[model samples]
Target chain A: MKTNGIELEKEILDQLPAIVLAVDKNFNTLYANNAALTFMGSTPENVIGKHCYNMVRNPQCKTPECCIAQAMADGKVHSIRSEADGGTGNRFLESTAVPLKDEKGEIVGGLEFVLDITQKVLDEKKLNEQGRTIRDMSTPTIKLWDGILVLPVVGVIDTNRAQHMMDSMLNKILSSNSRAIIMDIQGVAAVDTAVANHLIKITKATKLMGCECLISGISPGVAKTLTQLGINLGSIKTKATLSDALEEAFSMINLRVITTEAKQ
Target chain B: MEADSFRLLNGVKAMMDSGDEYSVSGSVTNRCYIACINGELSSAQMGQLYDEIVRMAEKRELRGVIMDLNGLAVLDSAAFCVLRKISGALALMGLKSAWMGIKPAIASSLVDFGADVDDLCICQNIEDGVRLMSFQK
Candidate 1:
């Protein structure tokens, strides 16, 4: 009955997809389950009694920081992420090392369980790239008319986003030689001191480039907050509506809009 | 000790050399002078150019002067200050001065460094500069 129990355990371990391996304190392979044998592309005869580092190469295999070595020394489990080579190809793997002990409770070797995590790593990389694309798309400078441009600001304004906004505005002004730009803040969440300062800095920078910057879409709540904070936007043109701001911009550039009657 | 210090200062003066990193040349048209400037210039070079412009203005019956900077790529703080001074000096002499073709990057950089450019009359091109001068006259 005991022999049957041990065989059943071995069979269960062999069926597992995770690689199960055992190495002695000297770093020589002692045993490997079927999954490990297949993953390493080695037969039992060639794998047994061989240096595990030479058979399965990893970034930390030859270093003192090896998880297996750490587990053997501390008599505890240790985990690490490694870029490793397998029967298939290079793979990202998560390996956990558990200390193995003898009857005397003396640490003798380490048993390791390694899981393939290539797909997870690839997914995380893709998500990060998508995040960058979204960040760039969030802030856009659009040309509204000849010699006129408009930037519609939305959401929270952080330092990085503010710098990007300034860069985009400056580059667009240069490329188009725009004489005036209207900044609409109707979609902004709230106007705090820092946000107001960022807007002012952007205004001053545009002015330095000989382009006039007008602030529009100032809600009553934002105006009250600006006054309460005592933040002075000196000499900057502000309008209650985008249309009024556009009218001011037109005047600055010596332009005007006139209505004509439709012909019958 | 004082005599030795004086001799050392004199020797240092003798070793000093001067050079201009930029060139300035233009023409006088219809009582309006256009000074085409190119390349980066040191403070001394800018001062020399300012003096040359002022002398030329004194020599001719000019109503306006356009400092064409389309070819100038770099302007440090000192050079920029001198440029402003030149504009002010020309205004004092009753000649309308307009800065032409100020590149976008340089203009932004000047503001970033906290240089005062509030009163500068900036023009998009030579024709706009001429129109600005003519209008002022």
Candidate 2:
């Protein structure tokens, strides 16, 4: 009955989808299930007595920082995610190592559990790249004409995005040597008295940098809120549309665009 | 160090005389008092809060008052108006008032709601507040 039970346990281990194996205290391969053997590219007969680390296909096997070695040293379970040369190709995997104990409850070896996490790692990296792309695309500083920079505002302006806009605007102004900047707020949903004040501060700062800042597209609702809040934004120039602001920007720089459609 | 601290999470309890009484943090005859507000303070609580600060300021040679809003989460327009009112009262009492730990959201909203921060001296934290209020400015 005990013999049959041992065979049953062995059969269950062999059928497990995860690559599982056990190594003795000396790091010798004591047991390598079918999946482990497949990972090693060798039969149990050829792998069982070999050094556990050397038998594994992972390049980190020779290093003392291996999860199994750490588990054996501490006589506890340890896990680490690493890229390794697997049975197929290089793959990222979470290698979990649990200390194997003798009958007396002393750790004599360790059982290693490996689960491929290549796709998960790749997906996380892709997500981070997408986030960077979104942030970059969201804030676009445009130079409409020489000495004129236009920042078309849209969507909600969180504190982080507001700070980012400030930084980007200052840098763009310095780099372009522009004399005027038209901040179009047509697409923005709402504005508070504080935002208007912050906008005034930005224009004041731009003025210090020798540039005129024009705030265009002041919606009636925002205008009403500002007045009700008792915030005075009368000091800053304003316009209803981007084109009107551009025309004002042109007049400030002593340049006028006389558009006459050529007869074709 | 008298080590007296009071917390009123709800507004109704603050109105009834027994709950809001507390001592200042420093010397036995300390002139400056610290009120560390925790949790949500609704608009209804502002009247009680103002009365408490006035009561605390009465006849104690009050040099300064430190208001710490580190734990406050939500702030409405009424609350902001009450804050402005309380600051004005403190100024009238010849007390130097310092506000500490104004969360980013509250700071933004205060500005958005046309609440002027210039009414009170704003500090970064309790330590900064203590230092600022300690000096005779």
Candidate 3:
């Protein structure tokens, strides 16, 4: 069927999941689709001729910055993310407005279609929080002894991750007043020249704080790779294993770890 | 000398020739000479502070010198270079130098700027610096 001589498939518009509405230049609601009427919790008779802002209160509502106003002014389609208040409570909506013209191509009203993005927005927020938690957990610093701290690094080392590791290690050393730090990289997938350089930087920074840094858990492959790369860790100590590093740390702090005999 | 000692113990404010405000206050606590540095660190200020510290070290038996940088927010490369020179000079004079209260950001920046701080002893606070000095002795 057609509305006002405009070919509009009313059946398709009514079946659409998105909320569609037509509003005049003054922001008065002219036509509300089935989804729009349902979202407003009102019938077409009560919704029509009502002010759009009075029904859906959003940040851009009642402002010249509204998507519909922008589309009407520019005679182009505009889209915006709006937190709209509807029958289902406050929801995130991606609203797109297209300028509606007559036979003369003069702007008369605008058609706005809004997609509820509340779930998508919630998912994105949850994902961001999880990423932060993972970033923090990836660099865990633990105090192994009175004056020694150990950091277990697990994963691919990027520039950002390396910087984060450095920050975490430095802060831990400051708080713990530890004289030595052992970075165990057994879980590291691989190490390149860049990663080696970052490690050197960490050592230098820690030394400036009066903390000796020792790198441990160097696999045979990593050791060969370092030699091939000709990356000198300089004066920073390196150990083949965490056990050896721990022993060296204990010696630095004048601590001796001895195993006791089993009791009968 | 007595007035100097009193000033050193009570903390003295040294105004540079350029009218910049800085201080190098020294006090003997736990037998460790603690020098509290404040205001923006400059080479000239460090030079004056070094001369005063060396003169004082000549008269007194010092376990070590703890340079407290708690009042500082940013330590530039020039200041760090001056600090390295001071650390070396202090060592030659038989006085160990331990930097105390270095902020984490400053430490990170120092390394990022490629400052050679390996020869210098750094401590978390005055207590740790004093302990480190005693341990070294």
Top-scoring candidate (lDDT): 3
Give the least accurate 10-residue stretch of model 1 chain B, judged by summed lDDT.
B15-24
A1-264: candidate 2 lDDT, tens digit per residue: 235778889888898978998888888988988888887789878998789867775766768878888898898778888887756778888989999988998989989988889899989999999987877676787999998999988887666666566566766775787768999887778887657667866665555344678999988988888888888877789998999999999997789999899999
Q: Summarize candidate 2's per-residue lDDT along B1-137 as a digit string, tens digits.
A: 23333344334456654444433232212466777766556445667778777777775667777777766776677776776788789888787777655554455455445554443576544565566667875
Task: Tell me the spans in candidate 1 whose CA falls farther than 4 Å from its real position.
Answer: A1-121, A262-264, B1-21, B25-37, B60-74, B102-104
Error of 1 at B13 (Å): 15
Q: B1-137, model 3: which lDDT tens digit per residue?
A: 99999887655444334454335687997667888878785666777877777776677778678888887899998777777777787898888888887887998888788777766777777777888788854
- What value does the lDDT take at residue A5 in candidate 1? 81
Model 2 chain B — which ten-residue stretch has the worst lDDT?
B20-29
DockQ of each: 0.28, 0.02, 0.53
Residue-level lDDT tens digits of model 3 in A209-258? 77899999988888889999998876779998999999999998788988
How are the candidates ranked when ordered by DockQ, highest leading? 3, 1, 2
- Which pairs clash in the backbone of model 3? none
Model 3 global lDDT (CA atoms, 0 to 1) = 0.85
Winner on lDDT between 2 and 3 is: 3
What DockQ would candidate 2 receive versus the native complex? 0.02
Chain A of model 1, TM-score against the native?
A: 0.75
